[model samples]
Target: MAGAVQWIAESVQEILQISGLTVQTFLVLCSTFFLACVVFNRSRNLPPYPAGRVPVLGHLLALGRAPQLKLTAWRRQYGDVFTVRMGMKDVVVLNDYTAVKDALVDRSELFASRSPFYYLFDAIFGFGKDIFSASWGPEFRQRKKFATTVLKNLGMRVGRGSIEDNIREEANCLRNRIAENNGQPFDVAHDVAVAVANIICSMTFGKRYDYEDETFRELTKAIATISIELGAGHITAVFPLLRFVPVVNRPIIKALEASSKVKNVMREEISRHRENPRDFLDFCLLELEQQEKVAGLTEENVMYMAQDLFLGGTDTTANTLTWSLLYMTLNPDVQNKVHEELDAVVGKSLPTLSHRSQLPYVNACLMA
Candidate 1:
């Protein structure tokens, strides 16, 4: 380690001597690379970004450790739509609901292009080509079309035996699991996460895993770890090169391993689907068979799409349900109202789509 450090120091000394560049000057030049990129490429009509941007690091210092909360503060100051320079990448954040709706929904096509995450997820974690991360183009369109068709075919849309049914079944399973605990106060977080994950599993993999299932637990753990690591808002996202560094890269190794396990399971299911197509996998395979095009529906695309569905479906729902439970505990009046309405609307009957209209309060509670 000392020798490596000495070598680096000597190399720096030689470069400084030859270029007649001081340490500060060299550092300044290194940072100016990102600043120059940001200044030259950005248009005048672009959204306002927060000030105090450093060269390579951009607004990272100003944003501090909790970038989300800091960005929320910046949003309040800068207005609904504002931009930020994360390294050389110019990110436009839609802070308010109106601006977000306008950008993402109203003029979606104009702003639909997905900038690749170069740092970790793209280079190392191996999801650069997935449906979620792929740039808006023919590839993304075809993959999305196929995936949507599968989802719709499996009753993800409207009417009976829909995604709601899938969720309701899992919710019942969750209730039963809780009942087994004999009314003892146990942490519902993990059970909720597993239940939510199982819904996605039933859709994608054709069946649900028991909450005690080892493989399911491992995958969820990996997904949770990935969420935490990615949520860190590390410099790696801004500076793609940093992902290669051991320290920055180590945290994601578990996520990648988990992804590998997930893809292997997907591949096995794809094989089964090829022989006798079952659920979403079968639907995807059927569509892929039609095109037979390598660009759109390759095995790689299938694996990535499956990963997207699994990750996308698991995290957000788990978070929302978990938060709802927390709020229910805090606000017992609302909780009681929800329960009372449920009892009065359909006593001794399993809730279904028809019950939804009769129980507006229940719907509102879930929505809230």
Candidate 2:
């Protein structure tokens, strides 16, 4: 296609201009030669990987429309497993589920470590002390062991009941807010984010806030910004060179600053909880104390673990709630069935954790 040629020409032109090299001139020869050396060095170091048309850039160019789908198609053409060079690094794509299972699950020790793409690991993660961000080592194992023990002792059956209760309460709040809008156009993303944040707050801090509350709103915005930015193409985990470049650094800096503010708030909250700890915070504080005394855990590591609990526990549940609400709105019959189940189970009373299991259709609707 003409577009393909245009891209190649542009890429070549940009390389020359960026290097300040004259085309077909002796003065530019050294710079071009240096560029060639860089390219060759990268190629020599690159793993045995499948490549697209472009040199160095590789399949990054052919990734059109839905890149994952395109990659799948490429796998069909190439083989079940293949590699693509994205810039200076190599990406190995395993197409077959069996291959993934054998490599990742069966041979986990070799493949267990997460790639740099884990933003939570790279930034705002206590310089690699938190279990989520900790590199493979004995310390990581110890931290994970502590976390598993704590999670098990949290009385998760009771926690599940608490979570179910919170979900119903949040659903009511969402419905009431939507009703107030009179079906007018409004952004539901904020509501979903707030609901999820509050759930996280409840579990971690044992507190909840109104969606409209200024503090809660700002907190949600910060988390949303951090989440969106990290997942965007702005940050590169695998390639350290890309991270140092000015183009990549700017957004990452902004995201990190925002994330720092969020962390400061979390730190303050942790401080407050430490001073007068209660409920889950008390539990965390007690664990921190034990770790400090027994395991010599750093303060930074403790805070990072708490931070993980706050974000991880909330965001997924909130997104799921938003999706479920959207689906219900598009299917009125399904919504009515949910209402019918709610009425039958709760008998016009606000639904509670005890009523959850009785509302099978409601549960099914939520799952769908």
Candidate 3:
């Protein structure tokens, strides 16, 4: 009996010792992590750190649902430039037009490189392969130069076979699609997205898909999914370490799946372009052949570049058109003025880029 009791006592002491060691280790690690954060923050000549920054998470919870409103409010308090701790990183916010222009236009070279840490860019774009997420360097400059040249060749000039012609054709298709709704309440988001994406498809693949084409529908759907997932505010974006957690990483997974779908379509287009060189993909392939050795222009780079163009062009344009329509519906007076301008300037003819100068109220409404 005494032996059993002594054994039990020893076991209890051993368990307590192990528990004590574990707690001590945890405290040490936590202390070290915080101390590192403090030291690193102090080392940099960073902008003013906003208040309510807790350890590790650091203002993430404070961002709330409408981060833009919160940011605007913070801008009022902290001026155009202020720092917000987003999880482990210190993000500098530029609120006003002047600061934005200065950073993006004037001192563009200094601010050209994207952060390599973002999981979205890393996973979807492969970090440096694409122009959008690439670091500012020779590879980026080469891709940018090629893209600019290709865009110039694509020509937005007001004439037959120009981008304007393509826009007019797509616009007509969109009008017809809307007419099918018979003035009833129906969502035009998908139609608008399809219209905008088709323009990009025409530029990239030298062909546009029918609105009912299964592949085209899938492509647009994937692009839309990616756009929504990006803005869906995944916790993994802030705390990348939490990517192991399934619920936290669901958005990232969805984005990856969407990206894969887009890439597969791009691959098919690229293969076709290889056989018959035409449009953006063809142009890129030709450039890749000449500059592959010097500029690190791989097939992968070409694919990603095409992906960047599609994603960048489609989402922003579609969203703008959607928002403009929403505002026009909300403010019929402004819409009437725009319609008056369009009627006066464009008349019964197909409106072209040449008519832009004549449509002042229409331009104002669009800008508004």
Q: Report the number of the highest-TM-score candidate.
A: 3
Clashing pairs in 3: none
The TM-score of candidate 2 is 0.76
- lDDT (Cα, 0-100) at 110 in candidate 1: 82
Against the reference, the lDDT scores of all candidates come to 0.77, 0.70, 0.83
lDDT per residue, candidate 2, 111-200, as tens digits?
876666545347767667677777766777877777665554443345552356665677688778778889788988887777777666
lDDT of 1 by residue, 282-355 (tens): 76777677775335566667777787888777878899889989999999999999889888988865687778
* Alpha carbon RMSD to native, model 3: 6.9
Task: Tell how far residue 338 is off in model 3, in angstroms.
Answer: 2.9
* Global Cα lDDT for candidate 3: 0.83
Clash list (residue pairs), candidate 2: none
Model 1 compared with the native: what TM-score?
Answer: 0.78
Candidates sorted by TM-score, best first? 3, 1, 2
The residue-by-residue lDDT of candidate 3 on 48-117, one tens digit each, is 9777788777888888789898998898889999998888777899988999999999999999898866
* Candidate numbers sorted by lDDT from highest down: 3, 1, 2
- Listing every candidate in turn, what is its Cα RMSD in Å to the true structure after a full C-alpha superposition? 6.6, 9.8, 6.9
